[model samples]
Target: MMNWNMTMKRNKLTVLIPPTPDNVNASEWWPVKSDVNWIETVYSDNKPAPSKLQGVDVFIGTDFTYEMAKFADKLKAILIPAAGYERIIADALPNGAVVANASHHEAPIAEWVMMVAVALDHKLLQSHKTFVTGLWDHWPGRYGPYRELFNRTFGIIGFGAIGRRVAKLAKAYDMEVIASGRSNNHSQIAQSLGVKYCWGKQGMKEVLSRSDFLLVATPLIPSTLNLIDEQALASMKKTSYLINPARGNIVNEYALYQALKEKKIAGAAIDTWYKYPTEETDQPRPSTHPFWELDNIIMTPHHSGGTDGTRNRRAQTVAENIDRLTSGQPLINVIDF
Candidate 1:
């Protein structure tokens, strides 16, 4: 848990950002190491010199709106500092610019999903609010006004690394875990982790209907965008809860808002952003963002996978990948595309 500033002193990393990290002074990233060239600021002005990039090994930037490929010829790899890289660098991303999704940022993100799942099953939002207002509550005296995970069904929509981790933790809660994803491979991992099979569209509907806790973990792609819209929400039990730590765009905000407003389902925990703060002017999110007015909707500032140790972990990964490329070794976690 050393400071990025102090740790960076011996290792200079040039970071180009239109916007920089919110914490710590911007100066900390520079002057890290004597031989380290890790010095960069958000490129808001003139373009970087295309001819002088021979020493740069790693590129950490917001997005390549700044003609990244020009500076990438000698770059070993382009590391998208942000977790969601699906929308970054669509056109020209220099040849052999091995892409790695920010896996280092996923731990806190998965923990957020777990927290929401636990909160929903225990009915924290509604019950805790009452405990404060002196609105002495009565739940028909149901033994489980707060449900227990002991024998409940937990369903995860994506079987990627994040979803797999979610399943492992859920099973430890004594819950039956099921996940659906790109293929049956998810179920194979689930089976090994003491989870059951639930794949494909129809199988997913059944999984949705059967789950006491449903998590929207799928990626936001052509086939998956708005995948859990009206019908998927309808397929879920009114008693069930939802947790989405995936891309906010993956779940249609309007559909979710409508479901909660109408009480079509229990409640939801949402992280990620359909819209993020853009531009250099530091403005607040537009008031029109749907979640602002929904009490049943718990909103997070995309801090799910954000932890104190995040930068160090990400930097370490970048450091390794850089070393590998310099040594002419194969890179790790390279996305085929």
Candidate 2:
């Protein structure tokens, strides 16, 4: 049996400690109903989020752990805007507090993969760059040395929310989609999404070897860190391309750069990077990134899921969770320990 308390006062808005992404903010959170109270970033000034948790029953924001650890006594529910709660210190959360995650938050991100895949397949960026560089009149190498999505073997790694979405979209492009995900847990889920699922280490090798385009959508876990490296890339067909809209560290950056430089695989489009924007967000990626020097690699500013509609989705989730907060219904996306 569970004992619940409702003594803490309720608020209408999601509190953002370190405001969410613009794609998320503009797309939804900030534009929510006028009655909500959203506390914009909590860490820009070297402070933690706990400074403001007193008497607030609901926390609709990101990275609430440091704040939770410092101010656990007053919290009722914590609903984060991001799908992944890795930024929060989960183990340290107070025993009485409840949590809700945003699983569908990956929609924008997974959709970004589809866009990048199209760009790579059509060689859009490459052709446009060449045209702008004074080669506008004539194009070379078989109309961009392009490839089509039809009949291509598209392999999706980590058939969780994002990977499964990517696979479904790939099918619309006429791609033969096969997915490898966490062992035993998501096989039925993958099949329901129209993907052929393979599990564990062997599954990864099989998918890597056969895929014409490989998409890395796995999270950054100990077992998944550097999951794609020399041996894995070596197993891939030299004509295949890799797309990572997921975490950066999942694929070893140096190994990938070497694979591209050596032409081990066709090319890659990388959205996530080893280094992120510091306090400042205007600067371009660092020179240390190997993808910057290689035309074969397409490196975006970690903007894969940064379309303008993301914020709306976030706020809606927050709102619905707030509604459910009092209803005592099971949360839609709670991350279990």
Cα displacement (angstroms), candidate 1, residue 129, comes to 3.6
C-alpha RMSD of candidate 2: 4.9
* Candidate 1, 1-337: lDDT as tens digits: 4785665453444443233467754334321223334544444322344434445666655355335566565565666544556655556766665666457665677778888877766666767788688765725374335557888888888877787888878877888887776667665567788877777787788788998888887767668888888889998999888898888777777788889888898888878667666545665663245567776767777778777677666656655655555445687767555
How good is model 2 by TM-score?
A: 0.81
lDDT of each: 0.68, 0.73
Candidate 2: stretches off by over 4 Å: 1-49, 64-68, 105-107, 136-145, 280-288
- Number of clashes in every candidate structure? 15, 8
Model 2: per-residue lDDT, tens digit, 43-157? 6423345666665666765565554567655677778766656556677777777778665547788777888778876778877878888785326454544568898899988
TM-score of 1: 0.79
The TM-score leader among the candidates is 2
